[model samples]
Target: MKSREKAVRMTLVAASCVWLFGVPFAAHAQSRVTLSGIIDAGILYANNSGGHADWSTTSGQLTASRWIMTGSEDLGGGSHAIFRLMSPFNVQNGHGTGRAFNVAYVGLADDRFGTVTVGRQWDTTIDTVSGFASNETWAGYIGAHVGDADNTNASFKVSNTVKYASPQFAGLSFGATYGFSNQAAAADGSSGFANNRMMSAGAAYARGPFAAGIGFLQADRPDAQPAGALGAPGAGVYDDYENTFSGSIASTAGVQRQRIWLAGASYQFFGALTLGGMYSKTQYRYLDATALTLDNYEANLTWQITPAWETGVAYIRTSGRYSGSGTGDAEPGWDQINLGTEYAISKRTTLYLIGVAQQGRHAVAQIYGVTPSSTRRQLVVTSGIQHQF
Candidate 1:
């Protein structure tokens, strides 16, 4: 009888072990995939020139429309591998923005070793600093600084890159990324005709209700147009023509170089209300050809009313100083104010309103010229509904 009891107990133990291992393996094989996206459309009214009159119907008017597919697989040992493919589209015309793989990357993550990813992805500056209170919460102008001065909207995403993020430890974490130029012969000094090549790095810290970060980016020979060539008529245009003329005089004239530095912080004061601000300065040097500097300041506040309603207001100012053989030390400036509000119906649907006004000074309008009218002051208002899945 004793021998028979011992045999039964050992058999039960073996059965339990098989069940435990098989259950996890079966679940891993059944891992799920999810498809999600957001569609935002609305009407806009602007007291501006030429584009669409004072009032017109606009789609994707307030927030961009996007679709994404993401999946993950358990790799055992408290680790997982994941991938995401994001595509942004223009809902108004049902046309693709050509960013089908806006964010296509794969990565491995573990509780102890953090996460590492390769392929196109957002840099540290955008992932950390740009999501704070002063940044855009629901794709509105009011949330970001003037013209997204600090790139709070992540206007540019690094390509051909590899990135790593440390697991959150004591409310503090950091991330870094490196984008390869992918040139066949970067060291040979012969392959320098790429349209875009950039490098960026940043660090961040968050403790309780306070967070702060700083970062820098450098690009070689990036495109620099006259200040007048952007936005409205009175906007700034690239100094390209002048640079060309100057280059003729000196064969070794320097090309355009762009560098940006940014720092920002946010703190929660009461309830769901938070105050945040950021400052960024950019310098454009024309390689011993000419020089220009742009200074930007932004401040904003975010208030969460109820669980589904939020409001944001922001002010931004930018000034540009031009020096070198071309401008004779003339300076131009522009300022803008933005306001935005959003209401959520569910985790995947939202309604938003945004308004912006800007002013230009000096030949600044001529400097920052726009395709529309080059007026000194411009105002725009947009209201839209967005659905996310």
Candidate 2:
């Protein structure tokens, strides 16, 4: 009788142990924090039509180096709280902590409802469709849409904003954002910095292998000029080649507004190859002035040579036109071709090579504030390695 009783107690203890530890372990497995980052560094060489051969070292030739921290806590009943903080940096010098300008936000997520975020963030057009083309991968310097003409990749981050994103269903999702001006009225009974406020909104949808999106952003011109000039005649306004120049006349004075539209599609041809293309356009309007329009198109192909090796080729073209009082009918345009290859040293490291060449017309001439000459052509070659953790 004593032996039998002891056996029964042992069985009960084992069952209690399973019940006490199993549920908590399963829940912990479903919630966790992840730290991820990438580092890309490379050497670069450039040749220009002016008989200047420039050899320079470069990094992040293929993709920007960045670090991200993300976490999610399950609230039970198919709901959760989530947050993410991502920072992009210059691998060469290890400075610039906020390339995305300090994206820190918190939101509630649900399996059925969607998500809402309040803080500094990117707009919908960029989050839905950017860097889907080969040009972004192959051409290092020439890939951006002519001065980031469209801001398609969220190159322009929004501040003091509230945003909402819908849950993806059947491969389709949508979102919108609003930024508050937060200003006080002026004594002249006129709007002061209040006029300098901004507002933006956008929507997007995706299904299967196709995606499309559009967004509009607007900002008021401050009476006081910021240090830099926009669309200036002799300044490297968009290229970041020179220091900020001060001017009295606001290039985008009054009310500044921008509208962007984009569409893209990708398809897998076989087990190892994929093809994709994208088109985007942006129109900028200055208070009572005619609009300036910029157009872009890109196409690319990627091939997997082996399980760990890949190569790609891409082409991109862009055109810009100005319509207003003093501007002439001349339009500028540029063409770029790029080739790139990559080998995965491991799951966390990669080596890459990229070559890019660009030829510009009237637009390229204005880009450098120089007369139109074949000497405007630029070629760049780069090779680097990247590690992710």
Candidate 3:
């Protein structure tokens, strides 16, 4: 099956090349393939890791450590054949994550029409609106809002996906994605789409110093683990979703559907400061009407203080609604602040220190990748160095 898919993609590229003939050159046709990635490591100090203050070595505290290989061929007539394979890993354990690749896709790009890709890929929510979150722009792991309840992190990529991105029109652009279920009716029966499936759409506008984006995502039976697969069911998306709910929320393996709405805007001031704000609402629905919902609001700012030094601050507030019985009936929320500084030693290497503080209401303070605090307050600090190639 995999070979067949690859053959089909290659055929598409061949057909495009034949149709285009000659025009402008592709971005990297002359170069062919490019290899690049980022590696970062640091010491992480958390006032509470699983109810205890601790210190440990970690990786990807600042940016996801990844390896990427991309190739492009000029199809002529302003068309290009492109393919990319990327994988993010844990620098600490030297282990890669999220399927074989964080992204593995083949596509055709044209200056006039747009781009279309097939394979594993991110949803529109992450592509369009995640940039406004501090988790991506400034603070890293500690900056994720209430454990990334909005599902904006790249940690969850949809498998079996087809995506289309339109060319910009007057600084406006839009895109869409669809992920196949790859399941049989005899196995996953209910709604026609009552299996591993997804549909997502997003739009963005950028002009001058201002930019804005909005995105929507929906998935059904997202916890699917097909037959003959390893580990427990719902390995990828479902595990991430459960972890995002933190300690107080009830963990359930029967998530029937998931939906998300995200919006964000940012502006640059004096070419030195950037200010941004974002909002997201995520719902994990099960049964008929029961759903676990989280709403996140965030404001973040970054300032370039000098040629070699930069600083940032982020504040996030999250509110949740739970409908289950027992402790789940009581709603929970949290407020968090992240502060960070980075000093560049060279163009590709930098040192960073970031601190995070979180106060949870009716729950234990929990940083995204860390364990929940025994108390309602938690503090974390990480100092690291990053190198890029």
TM-score of each: 0.77, 0.75, 0.86
Q: Please, what are the lDDT tens digits per residue for candidate 2 over residues 133-185? A: 55444444334556565654344455556778888877777777665544455
After superposing candidate 3, which stretches have Cα over 4 Å from the reference?
1-31, 188-193, 227-242, 246-253, 287-289
What Cα-based lDDT does every candidate model obtain? 0.60, 0.58, 0.75
TM-score of 1: 0.77
Measured over all alpha carbons after superposition, the RMSD of each candidate to the real structure, in angstroms, is 12.4, 11.8, 7.2
What tens-digit string does per-residue lDDT give for candidate 3 at 1-389? 00001111212233344344453544342436556678889999999888778999988887777776666777899888888887778888997754557678899999899999988777777767888888776587778887676766555666678899989999999999888776556344644344668889999999999999999988776555442111125453234335554233344445567788999999999999999999999887764345688899999999999988989998999888888653347678999999999998877788999999999988789888888899999999999988777
Highest TM-score scorer: 3
- Candidate 1 residues 1-389, lDDT tens each? 00001111111232343464463433345244456566778887666554334676565544456666666777888888877677777788887765556668898989888889987777667766666524345435333443343455655566667888888888777777776555444345566434235566777888888988887766554432211111111114212112211221223454455567888888888878878877788776666767767687777788888798987777777777777775668676777676777887776677878776667765322111112334777677778887755
Error of 3 at 152 (Å): 2.3
* lDDT winner, 1 or 3: 3
Q: Which residue window of length 10 is worst by lDDT in model 1?
A: 1-10
Better of 1 and 3 by TM-score: 3
Error of 3 at 210 (Å): 0.6
TM-score of predicted structure 2: 0.75
Better of 2 and 3 by TM-score: 3
**How does residue 101 of candidate 1 score in lDDT?**
66
Ranking by lDDT: 3, 1, 2
Q: Whole-model lDDT for model 2 versus the true structure?
A: 0.58
